[model samples]
Target chain A: MGLIQREIERAGIATIGISIVREFTEKVQPPRTVFLRWPFGHPLGEPGNSAQQRAVVLEALRALYQIEEPGTIIDLPFRWRREKYADYLPPTAADLE
Target chain B: MDVTRFKNRTLARLATRFPRLAQRFIDGYQAQESAGSIPWAVPKPLRQAKLALVTTSGIHHQRQAPFDMNDSDGDPSYRTLNGEELFDDFQITHDYYDHTDARKDPNIIFPLGPLRELVSEGLLGRLAQTHYAFMGHIDGRHIPTLVEKTAREVAAKLKADQVDLVLLTPA
Candidate 1:
């Protein structure tokens, strides 16, 4: 996945990837990434949990803009099965700008 | 006797259930070392940039050909996905991970559901009509094929579509 992201970013479109395994992301080093220490097949969090999923998507998009250095991987703070989505602060337009 | 498939599935289940076990598998598998300047492109603001999703969760339309599970090296090919129609009929075909949860709700791995919600809320500008999916688990001889051929092809497609940014997910 990181290899693919590299190719896409090389084509001049910004890219951000969500990585379940930190080691793999570290090795491949795509342009930008957000690492989740969660299980495989659940990068955005639990099934049917829209709030949790949205929180992740928001953070990943934020990473796409915030990361100035290539190959930077931001470690996300959300914990599996323990996060409170109600308190999760998404990036507002002002924040992103 | 599909011993290899059975073995891979068993390992997947075990790894999914046990993170410690998953770590061992991660340690054993090595990604090719990448050296050199990483790629870069200035991103447009979230509310104005055209975005797309790319995933390696082995997802595809129900009618598309399933990725090959017989090869241990894994499938290097990709499937074109239509964001507007994907959730209506989609399936996952990777054997390297237990996709039971993803099957229940693909947003966990694909996040198209959330991405659409963002577009509706105006946090994102728009989604490209086309997205992409790969089976991942590609290794050995197939890595070159993924990096050199299929991935670049998808990149070119994204470029042609004028996507400003892409969000990638992995299984």
Candidate 2:
């Protein structure tokens, strides 16, 4: 969350945040941000996909070094395979509300 | 009609329709009654002492556009809290109500008002000049990257200002 990162940063420690949605974070305006195009809840991917999750987390940690200024955003280059999971049903708008 | 039977029938129907919801309700209820009996990691005192609050409620200045609720379906990665000014006219637009409402109170989500109170009482060193917020249901791939980048930048500024602890409140 932007607030957690902000708090950590405010405490004189370095922080970074990865987000799936850009609009809300854009408002909070943390120093550095990365956007990924994936469904909600499972930020790193399916629960068992440790390999993919670790890779994504490592990439996010790496972004901290690349960003030098506040309000910088980058879109990661990754895609989720539809065939990877047959039970994958992303939440719908009605379900969310 | 027996009252016990009526209650049991109602609960059975509810569970059939929303099994996860029913489970969560039972879990939370039991957790509350048990109080501190469950084992979980207790957070250490923040070495970096500057404190901040985070909310998933997609709260923003009324002037700003709200987070895209339509983006993620059932398992929304992001969570929103209707706290601060953003919740003055807040509305739910997602199905994952448990995460969103787990600690639904505004004071719990956005503790700025209380932080200021602490400052007045000298309970804390000081509140960060600014706080942060986000939409909770973010996809994981993007979160690590975006959160890290923003945190690093914000940390630099906070360090420059001599802040020491950060209190993270996730909704």
Candidate 3:
């Protein structure tokens, strides 16, 4: 996934990846990433959990704008099936800027 | 199914159910590490950027041919996804992971629904009508093909679509 992401970023499109395997992400080194210690096939979060999914989307987008140095991977703090996401405040336009 | 396919599927289910087993599997595959400079693209503000998804989670339209699971080197080819109608007939092809949860709710891997909701709430700008999907287990001989051919092809397509930001998810 990081390999493909590198190509997309090289094409001048900003890229951020959600990585399940930290070892691969660290090796392939995409432009920006959010590393989650979640299970395989569950990069965003649990099935049918909209709030957790949205929180992840928000974090990736936030990392997209916030990460300046290339190849930076932010370790997300959400625990699989053990964390609550109802209070993940969506960043406003001003906050992003 | 052949012996290799059946083994891969069974192991995938085990890996998904057990992270330690997944780690052992991940450890066996030596992912190529970068040696030189990394590519960087300046990002625009989320509220004004046109976002697109690129998932290596083996998702494709049900009508489309599934990714080739026979190749142990893994399939480097990607499928073009139409955001509007993808969920109506979605299918997952890669045998590298247990997709029972993703099948129940694709947003766990694809996150398109959550992204659309963000757009609706005015937190995100707009989503590109098109996205991409690839089977993530490419290895050995297919690595060069992915780096030099198929991945570049998807990148060019994303460029043509004027996508400003991309979020990649893996299986």
Candidate 4:
């Protein structure tokens, strides 16, 4: 989607991406980007968790206004608590098969 | 371990073993679960709870317009999952949708089956009459209007049906 953002930017629309992974997105280097250390499937954060979603969304929206130069990336200060990661693990091949 | 080092090592391993699969898994997991649930000092009572699933799988009826792939490749906002029933013969088109290797399984993406299970178990209050799908790649150009329109229409329909939560599932 970063590519789309760049297109939009090329079309004269300012764009910002709220990416979970900084490394990959940094490579694309959109005009403005925000990296949050969040899990996949839930960009704005867990189902039914609106506040976090709103904050993340708002922050991304804010980046559109705050950043002046192209290719700006900012790492959000937020981190998930350790306990949350305890029961959570990426799926394995066995589960997929 | 420090967070940076931990994420770097984990991502590096995924990148080496399963680059495409790893991207999908990490994108899904990190986008939502990485930070845990965002805390709300005072959580608002859900205004509209009739739930639905929106994905980025570029799923659409063969007759409907396909999501713009070019847009998906560039902008994050152009991707949306179409909200149509899965065809019995439907097959995944992208390697990124692989969930089999995930520890939690890929049911997290299309939880419709699980949601049905939950419904049978009486875990949810009620299911919306319909769910939604959208490709994950969207460019955000004119998307605010589109999303608002979609959300409003969906919410209205779900509210009419008395749905209390919209479970957004990104594939």
lDDT (C-alpha, whole model) for all candidates: 0.91, 0.45, 0.91, 0.42
User: What TM-score does candidate 3 reach?
Assistant: 0.98
| Tens digit per residue, CA lDDT, model 1, B63-103 | 99999999889999999999889888999999889989988
By summed lDDT, which 10 consecutive residues of candidate 2 chain B come out lowest?
B30-39
Candidate 1 CAPRI assessment class: high
Candidate 4 residue lDDT tens string, B21-112: 55665455322111222111111122212334444444444554544333323223222333344543233322233323222333334444
Q: Worst lDDT window (10 residues) for model 3 chain B?
A: B40-49
Q: Which candidate would rank higher by lDDT, 1 or 3?
A: 3
User: DockQ of each candidate's interface versus the true one?
Assistant: 0.89, 0.04, 0.89, 0.05
lDDT of 3 at A38: 92
Error of 2 at B100 (Å): 9.6
DockQ of 4: 0.05
Q: How well does candidate 2 score on lDDT at residue A49?
A: 51
* DockQ of structure 3: 0.89
Which segments of candidate 2 are over 4 A away from where they belong?
A1-11, A14-97, B1-50, B73-95, B98-105
Per-prediction TM-score, please? 0.98, 0.39, 0.98, 0.40
Question: Deviation in angstroms for A66 in model 1?
Answer: 1.1
Residue by residue across A32-81, what tens digits does model 3's lDDT show?
A: 99999999999988999999998898888888888889889999889888
iRMSD per model? 0.8, 16.2, 0.9, 13.4
As for lDDT, the candidate ahead, 2 or 4, is 2
TM-score of chain B of each: 0.97, 0.50, 0.98, 0.51
What's the residue-level lDDT of A10 in candidate 1? 93
Candidate 3 segments exceeding 4 Å error: none
| Fnat score for model 3 | 0.94
